[model samples]
Target: MNYRHVYHAGNFADVVKHVALVAILLHLKKKDAGFAVLDSHAGRGVYDLTGEEAARTGEARAGVARLMDLRDEMPPALATYLQLVKEGGPARYPGSPLLAARLLRTQDRLTAIEKHPEEFAALKDALAPYANAAVENGDGYARAVKLLPPPSRRGLVVFDPPFESPDEFETLAQAIRDAVRKFANGIFLIWYPIKSQAAADAFTGEVLAGGVQKALTVDTQISAPEGNLDRAGLLVINPPYGFDVEMYAAAEILAPLLRADIAVKWRAGTP
Candidate 1:
C-alpha cells in the first residue's frame, strides 16, 4: 500500500479524490464569503508522466489518460477536473495543492504543507503564480492541526499523508480527531489506502468515534486486492449539501472509464 505520488500521478485514486475536491470547492464558492483550504501532505505540486517514475508504472495511462478526451457533456466536477488537468499541459499532473490553488477565488486563500525538502521547494515554485496560496515545509500532521479553525471559519482540510510509516493509519486517525476538535464545522477530505477492509474500517471508525457528527466515504476498487494495490478510500467529514450526488455522478462516468468499482456511502449522518 505504498502510494507515492510521482509514481501514481493521475491514477484512479487521484482522479476520484480530485473530482471530489473540485465538487467541494464549487460548493464552497456558492458563498460570497471566501473560504480557506489547507492541503496537508501536499505533494510536489505537479508530476510528469514522461518521467521515469511515471513511465515505470504507466498508471496515468490506465487512470486519467483514459478520461482525457474533451467531450460536450460530463459531470461538472469531472469536467472541471479534466479542464484543469488539460490546462496544465501534456504529461503534467496537478497535485492537490495545485488544484486547490487554481480553484481559489480572489478572496480565498490556501496553505499547502510538505515535509520533504525537495517537495516543499517544488511546491513553493509551483504555487508562485497564485497570490492566494502559501507553502509550508513541516510535518503535515502536526502543523496542519495548529492552523485549524481558519480565520474564515469556512475551509477545507485535505488530509492525505504518505503512509510510509507502518503506524500511519493510527497517526491519521488521531490527526483527524484532533483536527475535528479544533475545526468541527470545517469540511475535511481525508484519504487512505484500503489494503485491509478491517484496518480501513477501524481507521474510519476511530475518526467517527471522535464525535464527528457527519461523514461519508467514497471507495474505489479497480481490482481485487492482490499483488498490486487496487483499493483506496476518501472520507469526507461534514460534506456540503448535494456533495454525495455530485460524487455519484462522477463515479458513474468514471467506473467504466477507469475500470473501477466505485461506491459512495454515508457512514455517519444522513445526506
Candidate 2:
C-alpha cells in the first residue's frame, strides 16, 4: 500500500518528527543572524483531520488527539508543538513548514518543496499568508542539494520524504551527504520510519559515512515490527545545542502514553 501521509499525519511517527522539528527550529530562533529553512518533501503543510483520508485512518485521533488531551500536562517540547496545533484548531495539523514558519522572524526565510501535485498546491496555499515563505512543487531530493549553504550561511534543513519507493533510502542518504558537503555547518534533520532494527541501523551507518562531524540518531520502538505503526526515528546532523536533553524529557512523557517498549539513544562524536 502506498503510504499517503494524510493517513498518518499526526501519528507517532509525526509526533517524533514534529517535536524534534520544533526543538531545532527553536534553536534557530535563538541567534540574531537570519536563518533559512528548507523542507524537503514538505507534504501539504496542513492536513484536514476531518477529511476522508484522515477520517478513514483516524490516526490523528490517536496521535494529535492524544497529544491535545495531554497538552496542559505535557513536557515543554511537546507543549510547544501542541501550541502550534491548537492554532490550527482540532481539524487541522501544521506540518513542518508551517511550524517553522511560525517561529521565523522577519529576517528568517523558509523554502518548502513537495512533489505530489495536490499536496504541493496545498503547500503553496498553506504558506500563501507568509510573505517570507516559498513553497515549491518539485523533487525534494533534487531541491535539497541546490538550496544548501544558503546565502545566510545559517539555517536548518528538514528532509521528510514520503518514502514511497524503496530506493528512497539510498536517495535520501546521498541527498543528505550532498547537502552537508555544501554546508557542513548547517543543521540537518532527516525523519525516517523504523521498519526493523537492522534496516534502521544500517541507514544510520550510511548517514555517519556521509561526513557530518556531529550527528545523533534517536529511534523509538513503539511495538513489535509486525505492523505499519511499529516504529519511527529521526537523524540530526549538527544538532541544536540541547536537543538530546530536551528530547529525552519529551520521550519519557510520550512513552507511557504510547504504551510501547520505547528507548532513546544518542550516538555521536561530540556532546
Candidate 3:
C-alpha cells in the first residue's frame, strides 16, 4: 500500500509500457465505434519530474531524458509517445491515466482506479478536464472485473500493479483469468518487473495455463539481472492486429538508445 509511482515516473519501463499503450489506443481508434479504457492501479495521473520524489531517483534521466534528443529518429509509434511526453512539458510526465485521457476521443470513455487516497485525489483532479473520464478510489483489480464488457463492448484494461507482495504474480494470474472470462475481446496489458528469470517464467506459465488463447510477452533488460530493478516486461493479451510488428520495431530502436536487451515474442499465438 505504500508504493508510490512518483519516484519512478517516466522511467524505462514507463517508456516501454506507454509506447505500447499509445499504439493500442491508436489501433482502437481505427474503428468508428467508440471505446473505453480502464487503468487499473492508476497512479497520480501526472507527475512533476523536478519534484523531490523524482529528484531522489532521477530514473527519468536515463529513460525519457535520453529520448528527448532523438525525436527525429524514433519510429512512428514511439514518435507519438514522445510527442505526448513533450506536450507534458520538460518537468511534467503524464501517467497512464493521463495519457489515455489525452488520446481518448469524444465518443470514448475512461475509468481510472487508484487505491491510494492521496494518489486517487490527484488522479481525480488531473482527469477532471475530460468529461468522458472518471476516477474511482478503490482496488483496481476488483474494479477491473466489475467494469468489464463495457457498454461500448470494446475496451482496453491496463494492469500496472506495484508488485510489493510476494504473491503478486499469483494474484495477477488470477486477475487475468477473471478479466478474460468477463471480457474476452478486451485488450489486457500487464506491466511487471523482472527480478528473477525463474520467477518471471513461472508467472508467465501460470498466466498461460489459465486458458488464455492469445498473449504476447515483451521485455527489455537494461543490464544483466544482477539486481531487482534491471529488467521489466509487458504481457499483452489479445493485442490488436499488427501490434507485434509495430512493437518489435519500436523495441529495436528503444533497446539501443537505452543500452538494453530487448526481447519480443508471442506467448500464445502468431502475430
Candidate 4:
C-alpha cells in the first residue's frame, strides 16, 4: 500500500512500537554492561508533527496527542514513554534513533539504517548530536544480517519496517532468527501492524516454529480491522525477565485512555 511512515508519524501504531522500543532499551540499559542498538528500517529518527504530512491528517492528535493529554494519570511505564514525546511538545515525535540515543550510555553504540535517500538524510541529521551513532543509507533487511552480533555482542535490534508488503514479515522473522543464531544473547524487537488476526497469528507461528528461546508477542488493537488502522504489535525475542509485566501494565493503563476498543494480549512459548 506504499505506506510511508511520514503520514503515520505519531499514530497508534507508532505509539505501540516506540513505547515498546523504549521499554526494551531501558531494560537493557539497567545493567552496568554496555550494549549496542541496531535500528533497521529506522525512519527519519525524528519527525516534526507540525510538518505538512503530520498537519494534513493530524493523526498525532488521536495517537500521541491523546497519550500526552492523559500523561499525568498513566502508569509508570506509559508515563516513561509519553515523557519523551511530551519533552519535544506535540510538534515533534522522537523516532527509534532519538529514543535509543537518549537512553544509551556513552559506551553504547547505535547503528541506524534507512533505505530512502531523503529520509536517510533526515535520519542522519536527527542523530547528529550523538557521537556514538552511525547512520547507514541502505536496505536494513540485508544489513541486519551483515551486521549481526554488533561489536559488544550485547545489544538489542529494533526492527520497525514500513511493512509495504506482507513478505516483509517472513523476511523480518528470518533476520531475527539469523541474528539470534549468531548472537544468542542479544535481544530483538520487531514491530508490525495488526491488519488481520490471521496475519498476526501467522507471524506468531513463525516465531514459535523457529525455536526461538524466550520469545514473546504482545499485541494491542483499538478496533477490529475494518477500513481503518486498527492495531499494533511488537514481537520481542529474549526480552528481559520482567518486561512482559511492564508491557502488560502499560497496555492496561493505556487501553482505556486511548481506547478505540484497545485490547492487549501476550504469550510466551516455553522460553
Candidate that would win on lDDT: 1
- Model 3: per-residue lDDT, tens digit, 1-271? 6688987888888889999999999899999899999999999999998788787787777778888877456666788888889998856698999989999999999999999999999999999999999999999899988889899999899999999898998898888889889898899989999888999999889888877888999888885334337799899999999889889889888888788887889999776
Candidate 4 residue lDDT tens string, 1-271:
2666777888777787777787788787788888989998888878878788887776666678776557356545567778888887766688888888877888899999999988898999989999999999898978987898887888898888887775978887787777777878788888888778898888877775776767777776675334657777778888876777777777776677667544434455443
Q: Write the per-residue lDDT of candidate 2 for residues 30-113, one digit (tens) a residue.
A: 889999999988988888887898877766766767766674466566788988999898667888898888888999999999
Model 1, span 1-271: residue lDDT tens: 3546898888899899999999999999999999999999999999887789887887788789999774757878899999999998646689999999999999999999998888888899999999999999999989999999899999899999988899999999999999999999999999999999999999998899999899999999996334656999999999999999999888989999999999999999998
Structural RMSD, model 1: 1.7
Report model 1's TM-score to 2 decimal places: 0.97
lDDT to native, each model: 0.91, 0.82, 0.88, 0.78
Which of 2 and 4 is ahead in TM-score? 2
TM-score top scorer: 1
The 10 consecutive residues of candidate 4 with the worst lDDT sum are 262-271
Candidate 3: list runs displaced more than 4 Å: 224-228
Deviating ranges (above 4 Å) for candidate 4: 71-76, 224-226, 260-266
Using TM-score, rank the candidates from best to worst.
Answer: 1, 3, 2, 4
Model 2 clash pairs are: none
lDDT at position 219, candidate 2: 78
Error of 1 at 141 (Å): 0.8
